[model samples]
Target: MKHCRTRLLTACLGLSALTAPAFAQQACAPRYPPPTTIAAMFDMAAVTADTLDALPDVDVVLAARGGQDLSKYGLRHSHLAFLVRNDQGSWDVVHLLNRCKTDHSDLYREGLVNLVGESSITTDLRVGVPTPAVRGALKALLAGAAPQARALHEPRYSMLAYPGSTEYQNSNQWILEVTAAAMAQSGDGTVLDDRKRTLDWLKQRGYTPSRMHIGIGKRLGARFFADNVAVTDHPASERISGNYSVVTVESVFDFLHRSGALERELSIPHQTPVPAVTGTASPRQASSP
Candidate 1:
């Protein structure tokens, strides 16, 4: 069984879409139109695809996209996805995206080219490859991702969601929790299927998530109006002492690194060019990673 916890809706709070009023939802809708020129679109897609193609021998991979200016809060990559080769022998980038006009997010399967094209910001990307020890389990998790993802998923989205609490989840939090399912070990190396149990294991093992220092006005306004903004899932001690939780791709990378699951890190350069072709298809080989 899943242990879910949630609190009252808050107002707008996003570095990407922050700085808005209580009813900012109407004003804060994010939109990304298609690139103006075909050449511009090809450049973004080719660079993103080439980056993935460069990772030889990597089967299961974690990737992040930084299209926003999150540097003020010490964030580089704002979004994350798992890259795995699909059965068709082509790589795919799989992740959760919040469905616009709704509070829920569902799994999205995108090619490396589309992944780049979907970016609302710049085309820079980051990738993390796990050690061989964790790769097998990651494969299993990917194979069963749909059912498992749906069962534990909550439609509520919060950028500063509490990791330990089941109340809400951000994009990175979902990745972290799914990783927990892969790394959860009993006496031996078996993983825990129950999400609650996996979470318990993570806490016992000292998996620390990033905590953002939010001020009074931004924090209060977000908590009052936006359903996607939350504060109650955080610990009472943190609230009193003022340590708020915000899950980022960096936090998940840190947790995996601390747990010794990460083997290598790669920084993909957007300036690098790929041979531009009329077709948008990425060569099919294995999967998204």
Candidate 2:
């Protein structure tokens, strides 16, 4: 009887922790700060980009990082960016990021490693390679991506944003929409341009965002405390039904491949295992430890 009672109590405690409102996140709100000037995250991002560049004859590739181990919730790779060397021979990684650790909410483009900054829980990453067609479009759009990102970018940042809405955008969500512009195919079998048109096309073609199970407590607290976090973007039905859907790297990759966009993928250590979906995506594409 005592053992059974103890088990029940433990179960209750676990449930409470999971369901508990972000008392911890609010009271002890984990201060997500930027990396120090002397930090190595900056250099690491460059090194990672160079290493991806080393892939035999692969000049540009889509790189992603989870920063935190959300494997228990199925989001191992949470953020993404395009790594390339421009005509000026300088390596540039164009990506979107929430201007968090600040008073206001906005998006900014910084160094490659700055994406992870001091937020990364680990040093590993998972990389995705576009197909020739996708890559061609990706390369062509590089020059215009900055402005495109700026246009699609909403200063309101939310990790649990509605995938279909432009109200609030996250790091990976912006990339997904921008990439959709490059990879979207229309009814007449022609690729589309313009962010609004491509996103509309994505909706028509059954593109779905990944559902996050962050529970109601964190959702409420996040919105209450963080200016960048918004919970209303998700559908009222989904929120009432307890389904927290947010755009993520996994969803982006899944959607891209489902639409015949992503050509290859590479997963690395110190993170969740890669997807088993068929394609050129490998568990490890000859990456070093």
Candidate 3:
């Protein structure tokens, strides 16, 4: 009779378990506060894509150094899809997302090419003198010989060309040639005169000249002076015939100074006059000699 009672109790318990509601099998409730606008959604997606692109490109295994999972650094299909859409829509990528995951070296190379291309297009559109106002100001300083300053306005055509890997020795010669041609028609005696003066200035600044080939035109025939230590010009081109010159930092600054392209200082701190004092100071006695 006790065994029967026990069996009856077990059966009741099993029945209760079987009849209990299956809360875990129920569907999840929807989350609230959905994204408000299409533009906002696009912005969020673009930002995510940019974040993915900014990840460091170093081999994940090497970067992780045997601790973190390298797989985490590898580009995901989802990330690629996001990047494709962002690139299609955005004009300029402002924010880079993940610095750790992006392949930085490749990105740097690609960025250099794009910037050069855009700059070339913009520079080619502007005609006439490079800096007319500066030229006029210099002419005024020299007293009414402004028309003769036309020599300063001579056209110097610049092409973006790619230099061959072995063309490092040819850059300076090309720059000399172009400068010669550009200054030739200026009635500036000889191109070497200006070149010599420019070279002397550069030397005084502690720059040692080296013969280097910079691919800057339709053909990789342009040459310029480059010091390996003091100057670096990275050459990039889609085709050998379309190579561009990445002007050295020193060269650009020197050019701006020589051509008066540098900006003038505004009023100096002490130069501004104080308002004239209207009220008089206490008068001294006339008897005091």
Candidate 4:
């Protein structure tokens, strides 16, 4: 894995944090200041991008950020996306985002800085290096295969969407399905192009969704107040226990690592009090990944 040293600036700006689309599905309320400043967020993204740029012959990598702190639920990072290198020698983040206060979502292509600054609750950037074959497939699908990538997106958004169901999809679920679509190849060189086929391929490959323990009070609250969260797509047995299975950053990375699809993992930490110098800051391997 490659590493880079980046400086974090402490310039104070009254920059408001953007509302998280699906990662942080809390009750409707007033927004609060993010944990890190905009300058630190940009610096964290720069560190990540520079690390990728330092790698030899790398094109696509899995990047994730921490949005809402779900430590109570045993979760850290909230959302994940693919960072694909473009011809201009820069990276673009491709992921799914729910429309503002709506139950539908759309695919978005933005910069790494925008992704890191989206209501991030932590300063660390988590990245996964996929196997060479998987990286090649993802790079091809995300960079040049626009129509093929669009076909995997399902507009209906649900924070607790089931991995096996097609009724609704969460943000991480779309990335998982697209990953399956990229890896599901045939002898004749055909790949899974639709959600159903990709989902089936995921199941066949033994992909598992993370089970979140949402208590009765929170479940009932989200039932009535949360527009972007839904549990109807989950099976009755799981929903009755107040623990719904949903796709998450940890689950997706675990699947990739256990299935031998990932080659290495790296963690880029950011601290506001650190000196603003381009000194050597080596990223460590994540214990969980």
lDDT to native, each model: 0.63, 0.59, 0.25, 0.73
Candidate 3 TM-score, C-alpha based:
0.18
Question: TM-scores for all candidates?
Answer: 0.73, 0.68, 0.18, 0.80
lDDT measured at residue 160 in model 1 versus the true structure, 0 to 100: 72
lDDT of 3 by residue, 97-203 (tens): 11222211011101111111212211211111213343333323222222332222212212221122212212222332223223333324333323344344334
- Residue pairs with backbone overlap in model 2: 67-121
Candidates in order: C-alpha RMSD to true structure: 13.5, 16.8, 32.3, 10.1
Give Cα distance to truth, residue 22, candidate 3, Å.
Answer: 78
lDDT of 1 by residue, 177-274 (tens): 77776665312575565557667887887887787777777777877766666778889877776678766888788888998888888876554333
Error of 1 at 94 (Å): 1.4
Identify the leading candidate in terms of lDDT.
Answer: 4
At residue 96, candidate 2 shows an lDDT of 57
Better of 2 and 4 by lDDT: 4
Task: Give the Å error, residue 31, model 3.
Answer: 47
Clash statistics: count for each candidate? 29, 1, 28, 0
As for candidate 4, its clashing pairs are none
Candidate 2 lDDT, tens digit per residue, 1-289? 5334433433333223323321111122334333342133444444454455456656557778766567877666767887655554334556655443332234333344444454333646677887766666666666643454456665666766777776767778777876776664222445544546656877887788877676777767775786766678778888787677777778888887787776778754332223345566456874636
Between candidates 1 and 2, the lDDT winner:
1
In order of TM-score, best first, we have 4, 1, 2, 3
Model 1: number of backbone collisions? 29
- lDDT order, best first, reads 4, 1, 2, 3
